[model samples]
Target: MTINGDGIDNPYGKVFNQTYPGRVILSESTSRTSFAITVLQSTGMASDKMAPLLQMTLSHMSFALYNGLAGPITIFGPSSENCDEARDPILITDWGHRSAFQEWERELTGNPIRPQMNSILINVIIDHILVGIGQRYHVVRHADPKNETKFPASENGNYWIRTVPAEGCKGSEDGNELDERQGFLRYEPEEKNKPQLGNNFSWWAFGEQPLWLNFSEPTIMLLDEKKEWPGDYVIIPAENRDRWVYLVITAPKTNELGNNRTFISLAHPLHLHGHDFALLAQGNDSSQIDDPDNSVVLKFDNPPRRDVALIPAGGYLIVAFKADNPGSWLFHCHIAWHASSGLALQIMEREEDLRKTMTLEKLQQVNDGCKKWNEWFADTENLWSQNATLFQDDSGV
Candidate 1:
C-alpha cells in the first residue's frame, strides 16, 4: 500500500503527513518483543456442559477486557480521560484499569487475577525512512464564524436518541417474569428502548429468524415513544434523508427499570454498517447530550468521522450521520457476542425509495436462499438439531 501526504490542507501547524511519512523520531527497527497468552482450563458447575465450556470462558473473558479498558488511540470529544489534543496518541498509562475485569474473572473462575498487558506490532521493511512536516486542523463548531457553512446555533437541530443496557429473557414459563431464563441479555439498548424482559417478548421486529430475506414484508416502522420501545427497528422518513441524525449511547450504571443487574458499565466499539458517522462528542462519565448538568462539549463542524468508534466504559458517545442512504442499515456494538445478544438495531431510511430499488430477481434470490436454509435447519440429520431441540442457544441472527 502506498502512503502519501501531498493532498493535505495544512491550516493549523500540527504534526501530519505533509510529504510522505510523517515526522519520525526514530527510523531504526527495534528488537522484536514476544509474549505468550496462557489459557487456564477449569471445571464449571455441575450443570455446565463440556461442549460450551471453552467458548463461554473465552467469551466472558473477552467481554471483561473490552468492557473494562480504553486503548491508546485518542477518542474525539471533550472528556477527562480522553487526550487533551485530538489526533494525539493517548499514553498506555492513561488507559486506566477498571475492577469490572476482575469481577468477570471472579464470577467465571472463582478467582481474580492481575490485569494482563496487551500490544500490537506492525512490521514494514524499508532501507530508508522519509519524514514529513506538520500540518494543522482547527476544531470548529457548526455555529462558529470560522466554519464554512456558518450555520446559526438555532439551526443545529441535531436529532438525539438514547439507549441503555439490560438483561432480557428469551423464554419463560406460565407468563411469569420471574421465571424467565437468563441466557439472552442485551449489552446495548435495542434500538431506542430496552428489549422487553418478559415471557411474551420475542425479537422486537423479526421474531426468531432473519427478516432481511423476507422482502415481501420488510420491517418499516418509526420510533414511537408512547406505547413501547422500538426493538431493533426504526424508520427514517424520506424527507429527513438529507438531515443529520444523532444518536447518543451511554453505559448507564443501572438498567431501564433502575435495576442493578449490570453493576458495572462496559465499553462498546459501536459500528454502523452502511455509513460512516461523525463522532461529535464523548465523555468518561455516563452523560447524554440532553442531560441538564452534562459537561460534555460537542464539536459539530468537521468532527472526526468513523465507521467504528469506541464508547468508553461508564461513559457516553454522541455520533451524527446524514440519513442519505435509502436502505436498512445496522448500527450495533462491534463485539460479536454483544451484537448477537441483541445490542443492535436497523435504521431503514426512505422505506419507499429503498423498496423501489429492490428488484424482483434480488427478492427471489433471497427467498430461494431462505428456502434452502429452512430445509437444512429442519433436516433430522442436521448437526444443529439434537433430540428434536435446536442446538442454537443464542439469539439466531
Candidate 2:
C-alpha cells in the first residue's frame, strides 16, 4: 500500500489502503500467521534472458537458465502483525554501463512534479457503479395535481456543483522540509494570504462536462477513428501544458441513486492508468467533509504518491499528477464488477500531441482489430440468444 513509504502507517508501521470486501476463510494453522502467495511465470523471453527472481521481494534468486521448466516456489515471510521492516535498501546494478546508470540516477533524484499546475474535480459513484465529471443528475416526476399516479413524466435533470476554495480549507500552506523526499509541493501560490492553492486550484468544480457514455463504444477508439472529438466523450484541455493536473475525486454520501447503502458502504479501490498520482487528502467521514464548522483535514505536505487509492465509503480522495504524459488514459474503480458497470472515464491529455503520435499504421491496426472483433462477435456461435440485436449488458470498457 505504501509506495516508497508515503501512505498511512498503522501501529505496526504497515500500510493498509484497501481490504477484501467479501468473506475470507483462514485456516486454523495460518490464522494470524503465515500466508501463501501464488506466482506465475509469464514471460516470453528465452531461457538465456530469463532469471529466477522473488516476485515483490526484489530478491535475485538465480541467474541460471530454467529451460522452460515451470514449478511452484515457496517464499515464507513474517506474520502480517509483524511484517514491518526497519530498512530495505535497493542495489542498482550498473551492468558495465556507467554513463547510463548515472543518467538514470540523476532523473530519479530530480523533482517529480512541475511548479505551475491546474486541477479538476471528479465524482466517484458506486451507488450503481458509474463515474462522471462535474454534473450531478436527478429524476424529477411532474404529475398532475388531480391525478398524480396517472402522470408518467419522469425527467432527468442535471446541474454543476459549486467548487470549494482551498484558502478557507484547513491544510498546509507552503512546502515543508519533506518536499523533495516525499514529493510535496515546492512552489507557493501567487495569491497572497490564500493557502488554498495546494488544496483547491479554484479553476474547476464538480460535473465539469458530462460524457456521452455508452455501453459498447470505447471513447478513445471512437476519437481515433473519427479524427475528431466526439460530443459524448469528456475531453479535458491541458491548458497549463506541462504543468501538473490535480483531481479531487469524492464519493459523496448522496447521489442520483439516493445515499450509499447504510448496511455496507463499500470501499472503492480507484486506479488511474499511465501515471502515478499524489494522494493529497483522504477523508473517511462524509458527514463532516462539507461542514464549515468541521471540515476534513487534508495533507498537502508529503502526501502519498500512488497509482491506486481507496475512497472510503461516502468519503473523498484527492490526487494530483503531472500532465507530461499525453494520451487517452482511463481512471476507474479496480473492482471488476464495478468497472464493468461503467464506473470509469477517460482523460484526453495533450490531444494535439497524442494525435500526432497515433500514426496511420496504428490507426489501420486498430481498424483491423475492430473488424475481426465485430465479425467474431456477430457469429451466431458466440450469441446467447438469436433474437436479440444487442449483446452487451454493461459498459464494454
Candidate 3:
C-alpha cells in the first residue's frame, strides 16, 4: 500500500518535510469490493531499476490474495534479518508465475489497438530550451526580441513545435534580468498602470497567451493592431477524425555562453491529456532526430503506449495516437518546475465540431465560472502583489 521509504525519520532538519504512513488502513468489507493502490517514488527512478521489483511485488501480492494466504500477514521490515524468507520462496514457486508471463506475452503479441489505418500522422517536435544561471538555477523558455518566428511550421498540414532561442538572452548576455520586452506577462488591474510595451511584444512572449477563449473563437492574437490569426497552435481538422497522428518530440542540447558547453541536460516527462500514445522511439542521441527510417528503429508492431512518456535529455521521443477524441488537449512537461516556466502548449482538435456540440447551458456555466473569478479578483486586498509574504511561484497548471 506504500513505498519503501514511507515512514523514515529525517535526522537532519529539512524544511517542509514530513513522514508518511508505512501502510494504508482499510476497513473490513463485504459485498466483494475491490480496491487498487499505486505507489510512486518522490525522485525520478529509471525503469531498469524499479520495474523488476514492481513486477515481483505485484506477482507475489496477487498470488497471496487469491490463494487465501493474505489474512494476518506481517509487513516485512527493511533490514535483511527481518526479511520474509518464506515469502521470497513463494515468488518463484507460485503457481501463477507461468500464467502471468504467458498473459503478458500474449498481450504483447496481440494486434495493437491503434488509430485508424487512414488517419493523418502529425509530426510535432518539442524542445526543452533553458538558459542556466549557474549549476543550480535556470531561466527556461523566455521570450527573445530577435526571434521573428513565434512558432515552428509543418508541411502537409501536420503539426510542428520548435523552440527558437532568443538573442541576448540572460545567463549568456551582459544583462542578467529580462527587461520590458523580455519580461513575462503580468495581469493588470488598471489600464493606467499598464506598461508602455505594445501587444506585439506580449504575443511573442512565451507562455503569455491562453490557448483557448471560453466565449470567442480560439486563435492566436497578433501584435500588429490586435488581429486574430491562425498561429502556431495545432488545429486538428474534422476530416482527421479517427485518424492516426505521429508526434515526434525532440529536446536538443543547450549550450553555455562563452564556453559553448552543454548548459542543461535532463530528461522530461511529457504528458498528453485525453488520450494515450504509443511510444514509437526514444533515445539520448540527436542523430535520431526525424530520421525514423534509418537513424532510429521504430516499434510499429505493437509498441508500448501510455499517457506520459519521457523525453530524454538531448534526445527525442516519437509517439503516435488516433485523433478520435475532439477537444482542446494540453501537451506539456510533467515536471512542475519546468511546466511553470512555459514548457507547455495546447492542441485544438475539431473546433467546428466542438462549437456545434456546445450548448447554451454549457456556455452559461463557463460564463458563470469566469464571472466568479472576476468577482474574486476584484478584491484588491487579495491581490498577489498586495500580500508581500505571498509568492506566486507556480503556473497554476
Candidate 4:
C-alpha cells in the first residue's frame, strides 16, 4: 500500500517494496480531504483467488466503518479478477464529505442560520420498555410517591408507570396462572384514556425465559388521541400535505429498584423511513422538556437532514420533517437488539391517500406475501414446538 503521487522510497532513504509505512494526516481543509491510496499485490498468484481474498478484507473494513466500529488500518491491494497478474494496481479514491446543508442554503437562502418553525410539535420518549412479573416485585405506582402523585393503577394494583408493567394476567413458567401488566415505554395517552383498570391486559416482557413468550402485535399510537390500549404503536397522520412535523425524542434517565441512585441511560440510533428530517438540537439536558420551543435551539436554514439520527444517552434529540410522503413508514431504533426487543413504531402518513393508491394488484401481492409467511409459520419444523429445532431469539425486525 502506498499514498498516491508520493515517492516510493521512505523519508529515511530506505527503498520499501510492496509496502510503505508512514503516518498520513488528513487535514481539516476541504481540498486536503480528497486523496487516493494505491494497493499492489506483489505475489504472482491467480487473480480469481487473490481478488476474492482481498475483496473480503475490503468488504469487512467497509462494514466496520459503516457500523462505526473499529476497523483495520487503511490498506489495499490489486486483485482484479479480470487481471491475470498482480501487476495491476488498485486505486481507492476518497470523495470528501458533501455538505448538504451548505449546498441547500446556497441554493435556497443566502443566510446560513435560521430558526425552524413547525406546525406541530410531538414529544416522543424513547427508552427501555420493560415488563416484569407483578407478583415478584413492587412496581412504583406514582411518579412522585412522596408527593402522593399517584399514577392510574391497573386492575392488579400495579401502577401505569412508564418504567414498569401495567396490571394484567400472565402465565408463569411453572404453568401457574399469574397476572401481567404493561411495562416501561408505552404511549402516555393510554394512561389517561382507559383509567379504569382491567384484569385481562397483557404486554410483552423483555429478557425472560420462554424467550418467545409474551410477544405483542404491532399497533400505531396516535398523539393527543385516546389509545385503545397501552403499548400501542404511534401513527402520524398527514391531514394536510407538506405540513411541518416536529419530533422531540427524549431518552429519560431510568433507575432500577435495587440501585435507585444509579441512572441507566442508553444510546439509540433512530431511523425513519420514507423521508429525511432536519436535526434541530440534541443534548443531555432534561430541563428543555419544560419549554422545548424556547429552550432548545432550532436549526432551520438547511439543517442537516438524514433518515437516521442518534438519540444520546440520558438526553434528547429534536427533528423536523415534512409530512408529504403518503405511506406507512416505520420509525424505529437502528440498534438490532433494541429494535428486536420492541423499540419501534409506525407512522401512518396520509392513510386515506395511501389506501387510495393501493390497487387490487398491490393488495393481492400483499395478501399473497402474508399467506406465504403464514404457511411458513405453520410448518412444525419452522416454529418453536416440542420437536422443532428452530427458535426465534430476536425481534424479527
* Residue 314 Cα positional deviation in candidate 4, in Å, after optimal superposition: 1.0
Q: What total of clashing residue pairs does each candidate reach?
A: 2, 8, 2, 11
Which residue ranges in model 2 land beyond 4 Å of their true spot? Answer: 1-217, 224-239, 254-265, 287-289, 295-297
**lDDT per prediction?**
0.39, 0.40, 0.38, 0.38
Among all candidates shown, the one with the greatest lDDT? 2
| True lDDT of residue 240, candidate 2 | 53
- For each candidate, give its TM-score against the true structure: 0.44, 0.44, 0.43, 0.42
The TM-score ranking, best first, is 2, 1, 3, 4
Kindly report which residue pairs in candidate 2 clash with one another.
133-207, 134-206, 134-207, 134-208, 135-207, 166-196, 167-196, 212-232
User: Any residue pairs clashing in model 1, and if so which?
Assistant: 12-136, 14-135
Tens digits of per-residue lDDT, candidate 3, 294-322, equal: 67888999997566777667788899878
Off by over 4 Å in 3: 1-239, 256-263, 290-294, 387-396
Q: What is the lDDT of residue 288 in candidate 4?
A: 75
User: Which has the better lDDT: candidate 2, or candidate 4?
Assistant: 2
Q: What is the per-residue lDDT of model 2 for residues 127-223, given as tens digits with 9 covering 90 to 100?
A: 2422221111222333333324464533332222223322321122244211212112212332001111222111111243322344224454665
Q: Indicate the worst ten consecutive residues by lDDT in candidate 2.
A: 58-67
lDDT of 4 by residue, 1-397 (tens): 2122222211221112323222222221112223232221111111111111111111111011111111112213334334332222222211112221222223222332211111111111123332110001112233442323464545444343221222321112233222222133342455112212123211121211101111222222122245442333344455567898787877766632221111235656676656667888878765576775858777888886555677766678889778776776656664433444345665667766776777778767555655665576556665434673433333334
- For residue 168, model 2's alpha carbon misses the true position, in angstroms, by 35
Worst 10 residues of 3 by lDDT: 114-123
Candidate 4 off by > 4 Å: 1-238, 254-263, 291-294, 384-395
Could you tell me which residue pairs clash in candidate 3?
119-243, 119-244
